[model samples]
Target: MKFTTVFVALVSAVPAVFGLTINTPANVVECQPILFSWSGGQSPYYLTLVPGGQSMASPIKSFPTQTGTSYTWNVDLQANTIFNIALKDSTGSTAYSDIVTIMSGSDTSCP
Candidate 1:
């Protein structure tokens, strides 16, 4: 009976996902257009494209104080480069999006 009770409690425990999420694809091409979207964040939010494999420092590209859930961006980095997107909410909380890699323009798989 004790084992059954413990098993039921363990099975019922589930972690909730964080509210901030990145909606863009994992791959993109340089100098091409890409769309970004997210949900579960407060307005007056901000997102920035930062260099990969580094701490949150200077952002190569930044968006204005955004109130909507989506934004279109033109990537200007070279091919084969890695990057990260930083999202900040009105309360100054920040979250990092999935690491993205920029494909070569010649790569036909990029869209």
Candidate 2:
């Protein structure tokens, strides 16, 4: 009982210990270079696109990355779809960004 409580408490603090941030558009257009940025956490980091409006148990794409603050993601998908960024480090620590919607086409520019 006591061991279980302490283990649970420590596990819950992983996110706070390795903070991460995402700088990108929540709503994005497909087939474009969507720039992504982050801060904190150990490198080399891994990123994944988890499809929204469905189960998050799996990711659509995953890759290893460096500490670079920015990355370009070429969008290419159907409209009306949503997704969010999931970042992971070598130690199995993970972080998540806010959700974004993928559209067929849009005139909006990425930041």
Candidate 3:
């Protein structure tokens, strides 16, 4: 009886410990568009593409249909620039992905 109870308790705790995971492409071509993917979460979530600590001029994008675990965005990036992405749930819960580096142009500085 004790073993069965412990097993049930472990199974019940699994859902609470799981969270959404966001994954991006390993290598993205410079000055091109790329898609980001995620898994293990429900919908009513928002996706934002921001650089540094400032929000983009445009409004943050959202997914209306809570279907799959993946989302995609088309971003035009410049050379030697880094960007960050965030996934926010309806209840204000948020998760951040890793920094993505875009190297699309020459390294020379403008004179």
Candidate 4:
């Protein structure tokens, strides 16, 4: 039992030691460009945008490649739309960020 506990703890710590962070724009304006950023991972991280639980395999735009700790992409969002951002590292490990909701044009002052 003690050995199992130690193994679990070490495995869990691996991800934290590597350092990974994914973030999205605080204010996403409708019908405008929004940038998504992430950090602390390997190169060629996979980025995906899923809308309403549907796979957005083909994102409107993507970074294609990531270096260092972050990447940015511009996306056009519609009113009242919710999307999920997924990031997969080169080691086949995956992390998911928070959901992003887009407001309508009338609700936002974005051009």
Q: In model 2, which residue pairs have backbone atoms overlapping below 3 Å?
A: 31-75, 31-76
- For each candidate in turn, the TM-score is 0.71, 0.67, 0.61, 0.63
Query: Measured by TM-score, how close is model 3 to the native structure?
Result: 0.61
* Per-residue lDDT of candidate 1, residues 20-85 (tens digit): 666656568876888888876578789888888564579877888789888887767778777788
lDDT of 3 by residue, 11-96 (tens): 99875676776675666545455677776556776777566444444423343444466655444555556656677666655666
- The TM-score, computed over Cα atoms with residue i paired to residue i, of candidate 1 is 0.71
Candidates ranked by lDDT, best first? 1, 2, 4, 3
Candidate achieving higher lDDT, 2 or 3: 2
Model 4, residue pairs in steric clash:
39-69, 40-69
Candidate 3: pairs in clash? none
Model 3 regions more than 4 Å off: 1-17, 52-67, 105-111
Q: Residue 13 of candidate 1: its Cα lDDT? A: 58
Clashes of each: 0, 2, 0, 2
What's the CA RMSD of model 2 in angstroms? 6.0
Q: Which scores higher on TM-score, 2 or 4?
A: 2
The lDDT per prediction is 0.74, 0.71, 0.60, 0.66
Q: How well is each residue in 23-110 modelled by candidate 4, as lDDT tens digits?
A: 8667766756666677766766887666645444555334475655554443455667777777777876666667777766554543
